[model samples]
Target chain A: MSQGSTRKTLASIAHGRSGDKGNHANVAILGYSQDAFDWLIGFLSKEKVEDYFKPLGVTQVERYLAPNVRGLNFVLKDVLAGGSSASLRSDSQGKTLAAALLLMPLPPDCPARLFFKG
Target chain B: MDKVRIGNACGFWGDDPQAPAHLATGGNLDFLTLEYLAELTMSILAHQKAKNPQAGYAGDFITVLQSLILSLKAQPRLKMVTNAGGMNPLACAKKAKEVLDQAGIVRRIGYLTGDDLLDRLPDFIRQGIALENLDDGRPLEPFLSRVVSANAYLGSEGIVQLLEQGAEIVITGRVADACLTVGPAAWHFQTPLEDWNTLAGFSVAGHLIECGAQVTGGNFTRWQEVPRYESVGYPIAEISSDGSFLLTKPQGTGGLVNFETVAEQLLYEVGDPSAYLTPDVSADFTSVEIQDIGSDRVQVGKAKGRPKPPLLKVSLAYRDGFMASGTLVAGGGKAREKAECCGQIIREKLRQANALPQEFLVEILGAGDSLPGIYQRNDPPEAVLRLAARDPSKGIIERFTREFAPLVTSGPQGITGYTSGRPQVREVFRYWPTTIPRDLVPFQLGFL
Candidate 1:
């Protein structure tokens, strides 16, 4: 885990959006640059995402690479409760999962400043 | 061969009603696409057809057509492709023809059939075609009787056939959403059926603008970067002969189109980017590239693809159970605590009466129930105490609906936003995703 000086978040280098596919949800996080993308490919792992979203009952996570877009799409399986038809949650489709994931604290020795300019 | 401009006006059944007229009147489009169906939309249209022989299609297309009449007449070169024919394309096309005739416009109309597979499923089963669920290996046997609507996702072949037959307008049932753009691209470009790269490029473009304003800033991750959302422009993909396209909106319209917007939409609801399977082509979204040339215009390069999958995906809906949700606002101080108490009180009462539903879910709206255990905001001035229940027994759901109103009079001191009364118990038609072999579907195109 990163200390105060090295602590960083995905919001510094990436942005994403999520939606439902049946009961499953896909959260795609795209890097702001190739450097950020390279850092993300190694930093963000399936086990990390599965661990982060475990509180929401995400059974498993499958990571996929989209090098053309410098993005990684993580499919959070069975995380939408029962998806649109049956999920009783306010965001039944897992539309906010990406936003929630972007807030995850990065591992140690990350950049102190945000990577992408506004 | 010149570039083809395709604009999608209607994203779904209940999108902005003003979008059709806005795009039709202003957009210089060769083709206009209206996507009206979603996963469970057919089940609803099926229920409609069961009650009335004359109704099953998307009626709003007729209402929207009335607004597009003048534009369709003015732009004679512009054609329309739509899957607005939910459960019934014939009825929808007939209604559309009547609307056009009334407007004194004589454009050729076509309707495609054979996507509906409910009646044919039994026959396919007899022939040893196991319609097993794509998600799980469960055979359709146990849920056969409960199936309400089953439609195979037809590809662009039928749509292109209709266009080749000199049909100015194309209406289809249960075609893939991307096929709306893919069909027109293949017809206009005259691309070979085996040209998977070209089809993949068009399919990728179609997926971009199919959701209307999605690629042009709707649901964008950087929503703050988008401007003038009140009049957000619909998307237009000016596709070239070589499968490259410029994604933009009508000039002077509101919305942002850039690399960020384009990149986010490329993977919306998609799984493996390398194998984005459709009936037209198995597109590789990973090979697609985008360049933000300027404001409100992005150049999307040629996409890669493989041969189409042997089978077509099926979207089936069946009777799941009855469910209802009712909300009450717990206000002032200690809103979260008060809402929690109200939920406990309801659960206790349900337990005492032995009328507990099979599934009972309680959510405090303002307390970050969206993320549940992850994101939380403990102190809020007010919060919505929502009680939702789903069960096989109609009696259980009906009883669950009654429990909300009683909370207003008997529960916490701050609880008081139940003016809407008890929730209505409605049938839940859960989606069942599966696939069938391409040979099993006989998608036929006919002129009106």
Candidate 2:
């Protein structure tokens, strides 16, 4: 909430994909560079992601780090109603979950200058 | 570096049919892998087999083979591996043999069976294998009557055996998708079964290319950077003996094979980067390194592996229910409001008729409600209203399908885009992921 600070979405600094594991969905968010990855590690906490996808009725959320690829994978449990054959949702397999998560607003005080167009 | 090239052309059953011939002709490779089965594909094949004795395999593969007959004849050294034998490997192999004969190309065709455990369910139960669902830990007894297909994901051992026996084409049923690549890599390098590190590396390579064009720019996050999607080249892994490989695509073809593209694919459907479970080895994807070496080329190496699990994951699908989805595009000023109103009308009508389904969902496509939480838009010009439902009774789903058509005339004025007719009702094959003792399900290898 600082003046003169720019606000940006996570999609501007990262890219990701999501897939289903039964009723659970895993979203892998990858940063464009090592610096962006470090920034993500410090900012994108489990509670933050849980709150972001709270509307989907996610029972639990666990984060895993892959430093080699500068990526963080968050598994959202019970997000899919019943998965493949059972789910009635338009994005049943959570294919659009990653894109939706990428729309998360970054903190105003974050290093916006470090980000580059991907 | 003693290396062998393996290219995966067909990712799933409905991938481009011309991909196999294109890869076989252009990619100077040792093996061409085609993965036809998805998680629920076996249930469909099982349903087909129950209807006809001679059915239940990926018939599209045979058609692809027919188209690739000239390429098969031209590239005699190029071998093929596939799990196109959805529920029936023998039948698929027989059809493939006939196709080969018609082209006068004499090549040994081998197949791996014993993955299908539907017939052996009673035996497994007698042996005290509970086959509980991996997700919910629910007992399999309640769903036994409706079980359609149950197949354990086999490893590369059978595929290696077939290749060692001079089988030019090896077909299998329900082998791990990665085994299609690992089998050839292990056979070519003569790696031991317990060589976990090398096997793990091969597993990672296999996983990358298992989805065919996925590793080579298809479904990439950075879609704009990808060169050509119309003629996207399938992925080819040039793997070395020491568990290293270069992920690349055929030259002069569309699509990219950069560091970002390969990295994105490495995490596709992946659970833990440290423990990517496969039948061969638990590949540690985090240890692997990827670097963009050149145009459409990525150097990927340092993939470590752990010991194979004592049990093999089984993909069991049973008849759960019937589902139907219908979509209607709403336009004009109050599109979002009209779409929600339309959904409520249908729900109320269904409630009044006592035909309410087990689960009903009304989604507004343009309202950013697809993911539900993040991107809610205000007052969209138009929106596609998608109404979907599932029920145990087929009659209920059939009834639900008819409700969409009536909405065109009876519903809100803004409602449109209903020319596609009533939504077709489809039988739901719910997936049941479980594990079986490795010894209980043995790989059966045979030649046609």
Candidate 3:
């Protein structure tokens, strides 16, 4: 549908638990260590959170910014568990998903702290 | 004879993807060249060797080869030459063949190597050849133990040899960029190796196409006026057997080709322009000609040459240990003042921890040191503070990282930009370049 809906869908797929209400599963809270939070959300920020997750089926990712602490909530669609089945990950020439990812500039500014507490 | 038209697609591994296809079809070219090696890239590849022995060399070349495979198959007359082989041409060739085999193309591919000097360093040093730094002129002894890789920039002759050997595709490692285009022209024209003028002209042609679309319009200062930027075109070198060539690009592709575009590409790799030295000859880039051929086409040719300098250039990468940088901003009218105070505070904290390097640097961007005389502002409201240092000593850099947060409260203008904790130390790989006689170094060519 819209960009927002896609992000929410992708987030669900990445951290969702089994047996969700619909195709969108619950976004799992993958632990909340300050270090882990900083790294995960910080990686998102460093890599341009919205752009990075957009292709991964994360259409609408709501990120809450704070001083040294923040959180990003997204809706993920059918963007996980397929591995070799992702279209955005590979564009027809066997170039790895990592290679495609490298071409996109990381957000010029990285989050100072963990944007995601959970 | 028909003019030898050589077009280029990707300048380096990270270069734009659509370049080769656009230039090949657009320029109506006979040959295509892709140049993809820089001094810094060589160092990065050397660093990769520490983890994976076969990891050195740019793999993007293979990707580009794959991208153009279908196009080449459709156009049998289109021969491609590239130095994407990096430090390992034979290995690169085999990988390329793997891709070709998948495409059902059983063409004879030629690979040229011998650019690296891994086995001959000790002998060269023993022969009294002090491979001094071209920039600082320091002898390369201190870095002997940490030296990881060393390669000389070969010229067009080696590539010419491969082309003459009936190679449908020629791959090389660390050859001068200009040599990529020059070699094919020299081979096709059968230009005598000693014909300095023609060689220099071909050298100029090579230099023009060396950066791919840079000569066409990518990154040109006049980029604003370039048409259709969504699909920017790459450069094409139309060469004649007599040493004259034109610099241009595909029709209808985004990017401009003019004297200014050619001039900017010429400005790259600064040396005395009158005597831009290479292994084959010292080129006189000053005598070159650039004329607009048509829409998206510029004719460039008529260059001069001199004898090659006696010493060959070498690139050496050694383990210089690790480094890391952390930054914070202190705002307000006292921005400059606050930045200074932060530096002092970091020094104090690191010193008390007994973790300061023997030599370290603390810089204040927007401060006089960062811009030096570039920006003339009347006491800017904010300043970006930076600190850098290195040491042969252990834990010094990590110790320096721990000192930043204290400055958040201690510094004059408070703090900003520090979201993550103190930074980590990263090992630094340094570069060294030296020269040796062409006769001294030897190479072996075999399939992997």
Candidate 4:
């Protein structure tokens, strides 16, 4: 909770492909295309997305996708929760930085919906 | 307690044939366990069962037993347990006993039955146990006709009954993989049923070694760093009465026993870490700790178990409809984009010919530009495209198969791997996994 420790944790997480935020969690959303990909970069790259993440205790965003499989794999860091690993209500670490990554709009008639909603 | 050593050979039917002989001759094993069944394997066995009652079990089990007859006879103290029984444990055991008789081994072979619920289907339905699909939670009524094999994943108690009956070789159907290990532990330690932590430890040990070589490092992500790949050794769980275990492999054998391999098996097919469902116990995988004991050895401890779920997961596969699929390679400069476009083209073609059904789906595989960040390689030089679809209508499925080959001759990628000809349309039997009241389907254990 201290400023110095928060700074160090942020720095450590930022060292990942997805950089770190001061006290918030880090999240990355990988995509199959540029329109949504650009939006994600713009969204996570902006201050509003950063501020929105702080309320839920998110920190940073990183995204990547497999060109061969048409599949996207993401890494969310320092979310209030441990991301998808553990139960949310039970653990404070369960909050995730990649929460906004899921909210980004998708291209019309995209197959990604089948994955997220399914 | 004296060390109870069990060797596992032949992870599946298609596994290396020399594994059993090497393990039997090499290790001072008290028991040899061979696992040869998966959920999909039962369907193939059921297809065989439909033709002949005695034809469902793995034929490779007979071959392995015949090969090991001399070695097994030489070591009278060594026993064997396996679920190679597949859909028909009794038939499999009968055949094994006949083999032993012919070999003059004279060992008392036993068959563990009552797990096969083919005859009790209507009784279970009438009693109001709604068999639902685990993935979708749909009732089993829709695909009941296509049901091929229905068997409960019975625990070690069933296998233990055979040991009590003086059977040297016990054959079972669809028992949980870990149960093979737990049965020996229960018999040895006499651990009470309510002592769940011990059961959890036993289950975890069984789970680690069940896949044969997984815990011993065959499937580790860093397999390249592994010492020996060609002679990769199967796993062995050296358990203690206190419920801790040291996992290792045979001396001088191939494979790595480290943290990574154990972790992979821990995460395999896991739904929840705290409440992993199994027949013997609901293991808390999260609580467990894994550490490398030494070279080719892992120490696993602290796995906790909770009260088991009320209902057992029964995998029942019935005949739905027939369908088949074949792969065609698509390659070009823009293979990823072309593959996606090919999926759309196939569906449009099927719809145009009035062959595509409402439930038709085409999935494209190996499309580059997917997971763009992980690989960090934006444009692959080229990629292979795989397209698959399914439909209830057999004729429609058959019709859709004819559309792929023509795409190669006329489509963007004129060069394709369509030498196999048209895909065969085969029936897709639906699967049912639901819970039945333990009281209603009380297991009847016997030794034969």
Instruction: Name the candidate that leads on lDDT.
Output: 2
Ranking by DockQ: 1, 2, 4, 3
| Residues B366-408 of candidate 2: C-alpha lDDT, one tens digit per residue | 8876866666655789999999999999999999988887877
TM-scores of chain B alone in all candidate structures, in the order given = 0.98, 0.98, 0.87, 0.89
A2-104: candidate 3 lDDT, tens digit per residue:
1232132222111211111111211222212345445545454423534553444434433332211112323333333111111111111121222122223
Q: Which wins on DockQ, candidate 2 or candidate 3?
A: 2
Whole-model lDDT per candidate? 0.88, 0.89, 0.63, 0.63
Reference-based lDDT, residue B112, model 4: 75
* Higher-ranked by TM-score: 1 or 3: 1
lDDT of 3 by residue, B182-263 (tens): 7888888888988898888888887777877666666543345778777877777778876887777666677787655665
Q: What is the interface RMSD, in angstroms, for predicted model 1?
A: 2.3
lDDT of 1 at A36: 87
Candidate 4 global CA lDDT score: 0.63
In model 2, where do residues sit more than 4 Å from their true spots? A1-6
- In the order shown, the candidates' Cα RMSDs to the true structure are 1.9, 2.0, 19.9, 11.8
True contacts kept of 2: 0.67
Clash number for model 2? 0
Cα misplacement distance, residue B46 of candidate 4 (Å): 2.2
